[model samples]
Target: MRRGASASHLDAAAAVDAALPAWLGLPNNAEKVLLTLRAARVAATARGVAATALGVAATAPVVAATALATTMAELLQRLFELQEGHKELLQRHEELRQRRM
Candidate 1:
């Protein structure tokens, strides 16, 4: 009877140990499950990174076009400002000539 009770106690203790979370300490079965979960998480992260890289690759052309358009707009604005300044300078020169005459 005493030997049977000790065996039963050990079985109960083992059951409790197995039921405990992996973070405390894991038996073989729990360790396997934890490893699988970690692998799955890593795979998910890798897939997300791959998707992001593809998205950036797809948008590269659009981004370059937008940058080009912005540069052209800035250049046009500078040209207009320079033209306006030239017109003002010509008008001032004409006024000075009329005064001299």
Candidate 2:
């Protein structure tokens, strides 16, 4: 949270602010959106894993298993995406919050 942003820009800032749930290191305002997404996806995976173990139908077990496998694959893909986004955002945040040093 710096200064001079209008309501709309402030809203955008706030949105990003909401995304970032934690702040470990920064000179200025940073770290939000990506962290929230990460936490959500991890929670989703755990839920999905549990759901997969539950009995659903007799004839549809194969279909269900396939869907569960596909979901797990997509979940993994999204996790990788978050890792890359985190790396990129960390660099950008550092650049934005620079100081004379």
Candidate 3:
């Protein structure tokens, strides 16, 4: 089951990499980096959603709910950072491509 999930994730990453403009000229390793970043962002988003759901469903105490919200917010921040990093990597890839031309 775990292996299947990993394979699914890899397939998703490959699809995302393939959809990007080839003119960007990112290498395979760079593509992998993008994939990892994207996965991290997704995980963070899932965590945030789960946390929110749990808080709501459990009727957590105000303090506990606040903490969960804060954690979820931090996860969101991490996701944004991962996205930014991915963008930077793509930008760098493009710059390198232009330089090679």
Candidate 4:
């Protein structure tokens, strides 16, 4: 009975091993299929990372342009304020001169 049980277990193991390649849809080359699948996955991951990097690179010019526009607007506002202050000082100086005369 012990010998019979061991023989049955060995037969079962052999059957499973024989069926594995067919179960995985490979023609007696499961290792090749697994390696191909791994390579495909790595290629897909690399493509995704490259696409993200390209998206960031494409947006860089727009970001720089927006920053430059903002800086120019601030500088223009400061220039206008300074011009107003200068006009006011000139008016005050003219008034003082007339009073002295």
Candidate 5:
């Protein structure tokens, strides 16, 4: 059971990893953020899948899953914040560059 479950989990992960390049190729900033959110959703799914694959009814996996889900949620939130910060940083850099010109 563990072996088969492990193999299936690995297959799912490989499928997601394989599609990463296409996600990265998105041409627009909004699309990229959407892609990141998609990736985070995949990660959350992966955590649950992994827990189920382990076939453990233990509390540890449950706790871990909760922690992982929270972490992924926080990551998704930060991704948006970081995107805004990045745009601001670029604007400031451009302003400084213009001033020097």
Candidate 6:
């Protein structure tokens, strides 16, 4: 909110970062990131499996590219999840310490 981010965007980002493990912070968001990772992984695997089963060996490069893209997406998602959770933590810390006086 301090960033002047739109309410809906903030809420959507929060929603993404919720439902995850407490270890990941914002359980919901973490879960979302994990889900995205899982989905991407599944897609990559399916592409590979399909190509192999179809015996279209010439498509290996394309399949590999798809897998790489998915992997990069998963990494970026995890980074965003971590960043969003950190913002909440920093705000909480600032608020709590202010009341200690």
Count residue pairs with overlapping backbones in model 4.
Answer: 0
Better of 2 and 4 by lDDT: 2
Clashes by residue pair, model 3: none
Residue range with the least summed lDDT across 10 consecutive positions in model 4: 57-66
Find the candidate with the highest lDDT and give its number. Answer: 3
Q: Write the per-residue lDDT of candidate 5 for residues 10-86, one digit (tens) a residue.
A: 99898876563436575435545555676677666766665676675435635354665567667767866775676
Those runs of model 4 whose alpha carbons end farther than 4 Å from true positions after fitting are 1-65
Q: Write the per-residue lDDT of candidate 2 for residues 1-101, one digit (tens) a residue.
A: 44655767979877775543354354332343455565677766655564557653333435444565677668777877776687688778778778533
What are the per-residue Cα lDDT tens digits for candidate 4 across 7-28? 9999998877545454756653
Query: For residues 1-101, could you state the per-residue lDDT of candidate 6 as single tens digits?
Result: 55556877889788865545655455445645565676567666765665675565645555345554566567666766775676688578878988996
TM-score of each: 0.36, 0.37, 0.42, 0.36, 0.39, 0.36
Model 3 residue 61 lDDT score: 44
Error of 5 at 25 (Å): 15
Q: Write the per-residue lDDT of candidate 3 for residues 1-100, one digit (tens) a residue.
A: 6999999999988886667545477664665566567767776666657656665433344434456567766876786777668778878988999999
Over 4 Å off in model 5, which ranges?
1-65
Report lDDT per candidate.
Answer: 0.58, 0.61, 0.68, 0.58, 0.66, 0.63
Distance (Å) between predicted and true CA of 75, model 4?
0.3
Q: How far out, in Å, is residue 80 in model 2?
A: 1.6
User: Which residue pairs does candidate 1 place in steric collision?
Assistant: none
Give candidate 5's whole-model lDDT. 0.66
